[model samples]
Target: MSGSRIDFRKAKFLISAPDIAHLDEHLPGDVGVEIAFAGRSNAGKSSALNQLTEQKGLARTSKTPGRTQLINVFELDEHRRLVDLPGYGFAKVPLTLKKKWQQALGQYLQERSCLSGVVVLMDIRHPLKDLDMQMIEWAVESDIPVLALLTKADKLAQSARMKMVNEVRKHLADFGDAVKVEPFSSLKGIGKSKVLGILDEWCKPQWLMDTLEQAEEE
Candidate 1:
């Protein structure tokens, strides 16, 4: 059977809050795979995570931007974690606090060795804002695998959505084709296959394979 067919059924909500690393600490220590989602406020990050996991209310949703002020972690299994990062941009907060939040997020993204990949969610209409670019640049510099989810596809016409996808790809080309960019809508169930397929690949625990391969090489 095709690996893409593998079912990533929804798991229980392990925890919730604003701190990313603190939430990570509450996670299973033996976690072998992790895929984190990051995006701006109201970019549908929580909704996309909920849809992908096939679990409603896995992550809290709010009409208010920046409601998710901390990094939320959802443990998928004994060995996997799906993280929901705080939204950036137009958070309507103090400048100093914003910088602090950004720094915390940056530290996690750049330093988390356990992170397998990052799912960067972008609103279909406004995909690459300045803050979005910063996050993308950080991921690029860290050499982390990233998949762009062009969310809210249903809000646009079919042709317009495709154009937006191409534009996002063009903007991200500097990061390399490994940065998978695709249109998606949790409401419409579009791009579900693409997202899940990418997750399946990242969930493979390549570090473990490499460890075994190296031992054999020795």
Candidate 2:
């Protein structure tokens, strides 16, 4: 592989798993690269994914928060996958169900060996909630790169948006190169290219690059 750009528009729904056990059973062994998308309920996670893949209904947008109750996987290629994790916090679901969902989310984050990157979407108007911070910290601690996407950037004025972006950058500056923050709007298509570029970088792991190089040599 030449570390080529991935055509995210080609993303297709692969499978949905309710828990890590099912995920392991379905995918088995955690062999390839997986970039996960995580955010709170109604944080525009589905919208961001739809925009990224250019599929209007790929991730199933819903007016109801927490409709994405399962671990939805989308395949870009055999060696690469995009995971749509269930939304956390602010979902009006039952207490027991909420706890189960949270458990699954935590398990996936802590145990998934193939998770190469995480895109944590947050509302620009209300960025960096406690859950969001925890997600970022977990990814950073796990040595997985994160794209802290401030979603719905169009809701704010240009000045405000830029200011919030800077403030978030400063707040997360301690993480250094492990995290990258950006303003994104699914409606306006803002920052889509930049986000995709970052994802393209994540898709080309050193192991995959080495394999591609060896294949070329053969």
Candidate 3:
């Protein structure tokens, strides 16, 4: 995260996993940190991920919802990762498959030791649904930090966008202090900076801790 900017043009395909056992093969132990992008099927999660990484076709944008069915992993470097989690709440898949996804996702969020945080995306027009709240609350319950992005802010007027952002922030306050909500638009590149800033912070190198310690001693 410190050596160079997070250019998704440089993001190589790591792997896609249907379960945690496969994910563990690539990112074992606490050697690296992952920030996951998760949301409902039509929330524009893939688009937001591509915009942040600066790659157009990196995550595949499609009109047909529920195109992504696995945990897609992309690496910024050896130390940092951006994970595109399967969208929830409306995939045309079978009930058994849907249940499988939910169980796997729950395990990944709660048990993945190196998972640093989660970036939850929701459409600005429909900010906080029960499913969205459940997702955010799940991460909070796991003691994982969450950044909720109100995607597609470009569709709304500035006043409406700000109002939604405020309302989201206030409602998430019920979850915990770790929850943060912001307005984002991938098409217009709105809030990309904030997303990147959080990634860089989470993926900050281990050496920075030494510098802080020395400064404190001085």
Residues forming the 10-long window of minimal summed lDDT in candidate 2: 1-10
- Angstrom error of the Cα, residue 25, model 3: value is 3.0
Q: lDDT of each model, Cα atoms only?
A: 0.78, 0.92, 0.81
Judging by TM-score against the true structure, name the best candidate: 2
**How well does candidate 2 match the true structure in TM-score terms?**
0.96
- Candidate 1 versus the native: TM-score? 0.87
- lDDT per residue, candidate 2, 1-218, as tens digits? 55558999999998899988998887847877999999999899999999989999998998998976899999998889999998999556789999999999999999989999999999999999999999999899999999999999999999999999999999999999999999999999999999999999999998988987888799
Write the residue-wise lDDT of candidate 3 on 1-218 in tens digits. Answer: 14445555677668899977788886655556788888998999878877887788788888988866788888887666788888888667899989988877877777777788898899999878898888888888888888998999999999989998998888777776688888899999988788777777766645644554566689
Error of 2 at 142 (Å): 0.8
Off by over 4 Å in 3: 1-9, 28-30, 205-218
Pitting candidate 2 against candidate 3, the one with the higher lDDT is 2
22: Cα error in model 1, Å: 2.5
Residue pairs in candidate 2 whose N, alpha carbon or C atoms collide under 3 angstroms: 1-212
For model 1, how does the per-residue alpha-carbon lDDT over 183-217 read when each residue is reduced to its tens digit?
99989899998889888888776565576567768
Weakest ten-residue segment in model 1 by summed lDDT: 1-10
